[model samples]
Target: MPSAPTVIQHPPRREGLGPPIAAGVVTALVGFTSSFAVVLAGLQSVGATQSQAASGLLALTLTFGAAILWLSWRSKMPVTLAWSTPGAALLASAGMVDGGWPAAVGAFLLVGVLILLTGLLPVLGRLMGRIPTALAQAMLAGVLLPLCLAPFKSLGTAPLLVGPVALCWLLLLKLAPRWAVPGALVVALAVIGIHLGVNGTYLPADALVPRLEWTTPAFSVEAAVGLALPLFIVTMASQNIPGVAVLKSFGFTTPWRSSMVMTGAGTMAGAVFGGHAINLAALSAALAAGEEAGRNPGQRWRAAFVSGLAYLVLAVFSAALVTVVAAAPPGLLEAVAGLALLGTLAAAISSALAEAEERVPACITFLLAASGLSFGGIGAAFWALTCGILVRWLLKPGPLVRKARGSGPRAPRQ
Candidate 1:
């Protein structure tokens, strides 16, 4: 027999600057626009002063920015960090605690400690790793469903403002998919500008100056059980776990333990300046880590680094950005957020329903999550995951065994 033909392997193509830059800019825009207001509102709900709210946003952006840069550089992977949007939503709903913002800050610190402990403890890390991808994706889809519906709802409420933005997004999706989100953003900004001009309202001058304020944390049992525990649960279930799954879906290897540790530390650092929680990013992670970020997967880390830089730059102007967002028409931000997240929402649904055996359980998870129900202070995300897992165990013990044996659907490689 002739000797086997020699195999040749080509190295990954080096990515140019454009893809990374575009990816970075998109990631920044989506991350900032989608939920910064929720963060501001949550801070205020807990009784933060206007300066405290601005400081919270600034601290969060800076903390996540540094975390993303450091993690991506260290891992040589696109590792995006984010403040926990769902957790902020939870805070927004939870309202003021007994000790006010100080108690809430104390609760935030406690949550960070819990996250850090989870990372340090092998059992907790293993448990998080064991969460099936389908169920996790389902929960994510559920968490995102309400927000995803915003554009269509906006179309009915403010057709002039949202119709053009949606049309631009669709057109760009067909003609230049990479620019679709940015195009939508441009249309939204233009509409906002027109509205401002027509309404004779201008952005506040003081918005440009970044400010920082600190509140001394006062721990309270009410806040700890009510805010801290629930915030921790939602952040992990709705954000960090899905974030890891997103990375895995893109064939990236993530050191989950280290990521958890870093996010926990970042959250703690941010809490000092009134920031609530920081964690891994799911939707924006895809923007920075996916094929759009770079032709070569190996080089995509640069995109995350660029995103981090963008975030840092955004932090410097966070107050100004908040002012502009606040001044925009009621549904404009929702439209922008929905457009940017459409891709992520579709991907999550696809992933959730990919396996025939897991479909029922995944659907259950999605429905419960989308229902947005909370009980005894715990959010729906956790309950959704728990119910799905229980149903999976009860209905398909065989597949569950295989899953436990590491032979099920090869969940995102890492």
Candidate 2:
């Protein structure tokens, strides 16, 4: 018999709660402030009034916070959960569904049902997995392009309002890459304040209180095919699956069944209160799972736990944040939203084009998505994936893929 493979195990990590606690704080801050604007924009796109949108924001924050706490504690892993930012970006691009807000809410409920079924049925997860990574990423990149362009576009239309926000983002990206978007948001708020003062804008009293608004859901064929399917795909492809991969990188096995079940349930519960979707944290998962959280993988779950508590604390101020956005000059907050999505868009594009053999198919997907094409009841995302995959199959590569595994792997992105 071959000699037993040498077993390697990490030395016991030093005992300390301080590092993980601090990491948790940073994780919450980065996770919330970085993409809250995207959440607001996405809700608005699907026809949410400002008050409804704020309620949606609060619901997502609370539900995911509770989910994270439960999962991390039960699984003993840094199992972070978040509102699906890419899914939000998709909604922002997909625009109003055929049946308006109730239909959109109904679609959100549909996404929840699908996600729950995915958890209960392993085949569903595998089926989603069969969607080619290139096409999926290409669709995401396509959805993101227009939103990402808002910053530079605003530079022409509202230069004074958006210019300083962009400058601050650029400056901090070099000094502290982690804080760039949040920093830009701060500057944008300041600009909004000046604008409000100059114009004597009066903020409504109700905008300062955290509240929940319930919308009775009503499904439509259009919303089911267009809004729900695409949202589910984006959350699964961009956030939930990648979140598992991220924790695995740090040597923690996510409890898949429990995670999906909890997140799916959370999504459904929050949808009645106007929340869109919640999924595993993709990028933010790293903040709680990485070595910065603690040398010991065992203790890092604490970081995720603390981060959950932090989100609940943050939820108290959701209405105020929305109030600020409502008062801001149009395109100013959108400019910040664009800045927030830049990194995600760049990563998506890189991943979509990683395989030299798949570049053409990916481009087709991207262009169709960006073109905002819709047919029948379906939107561009579904059509983009359909066309790209069909094109990819018809044009299979024989030679170009020989070295793709070696050459196309993204050292940074994955």
Candidate 3:
């Protein structure tokens, strides 16, 4: 007899924690170090007075941190959002010349709108699909590599300042993987405490007070072509792409469109609040996704929420937060950031050059990215992709060379 219909049973799935929570916390610390500095740098270039820049910084901190917290919490995903550091660099170098604060704000708003459109448009999804995986991986490596280097470079000036933090980070990584970041922070803080105890004073505080100033959006040919386009490209190519990859790397699958939507909406909020731009945070996501958040990926949202809440608190007292962080000797900040990013850097390099076919191109991309070049109001992140493509094309085998030798399938000779 045809067998009675067979019944199939599926096992219930258990939610668990990942490696990202601890990673997220550590990465967030590093991410926060020079991140706001980029924005302030950009603002200064664009002619923002000290007070305007301070307000802008406060807005950016609050906006990005809150976004990460809210999205992670509501989505029950280890999603994280952060300001686009690369984007800030682009502004600092090129965008400042084209338009002032008004232009920058307009560009930010436009980027948000573009991201929103990208989220809503199915065609954009297909386009994202079309980017070769190897190329995308290389792009991420290119963008993150500089951040990984800053910590080490800062060492030349302040080895004593950075040594203990570096040692603490490495030791914690080896002996207690989960506590590495927190442990390093503790050591750094302890050093600060000791130095202060002996000296009876830390560095004097640099107070920044937020003020209200509304910049009306201004549109110009130069601003649109020069400032806006570059901002959009960096935010999308360098920031959002890697952000999504980090999530997928951890087995989280939310629609790319949805992420685009969140970023677009978030950017708008930031622009209104005097912030430059916000995007997905790859490094911080690593922290929120780590083992400390809980085994269930779904529960890691709490860490994100906590981070966001912390960010808001920082925003409220941004002058104080920035002052404290900035007070750390440049070398120490650099060392801590570099040490924290060691793992992420290793991973990006490994993935970018994994394929023999892509290695030369990827290497070229990485080098260009590390060179710290900016041009015509765009950053190295864009140039790296451009150079990588050029390398791939130049290295491609000629069709004539392939056609000259092969005409027909040969019979197997035994």
lDDT of 3 by residue, 1-414 (tens): 797998888887754333443445555565665355556656655666666666677767776776676677668877777887666655654535455677777877887887788899978756755654555456555655655666677666677767777777778788977567657766766776676677676655446454445667666655665556656666776677778787788888655666678778877776754566788886567777666666766677666766676666557655654455455554554455445545655766787788998899888877776665667755555677677888888887788866865656889999
User: Is candidate 2 or 3 superior in TM-score?
Assistant: 2
Tell me, by TM-score, which candidate is best: 2
For model 1, the superposed segments whose C-alpha errors exceed 4 Å read 1-53, 72-80, 85-107, 215-258, 272-274, 280-307, 396-414
Cα miss at 179, model 3 (Å)? Answer: 5.0
Deviation from native of the Cα of residue 289 in model 1, angstroms: 6.3
Which lDDT value does model 3 have at 216?
72
Full-model lDDT for every candidate: 0.82, 0.93, 0.66
TM-score for each predicted model, relative to the true structure: 0.73, 0.92, 0.70
- How many clashes show up in model 3? 19
Q: Superpose all Cα atoms of candidate 2 onto the true structure and report the RMSD in Å to 1 decimal.
A: 7.9
State, as a TM-score between 0 and 1, how close model 3 is to the true structure: 0.70
Candidate 3 weakest lDDT stretch, 10 residues:
15-24
Q: What is the lDDT of residue 24 in candidate 3?
A: 52
* Rank list by TM-score: 2, 1, 3
Say which candidate scores most in lDDT.
2
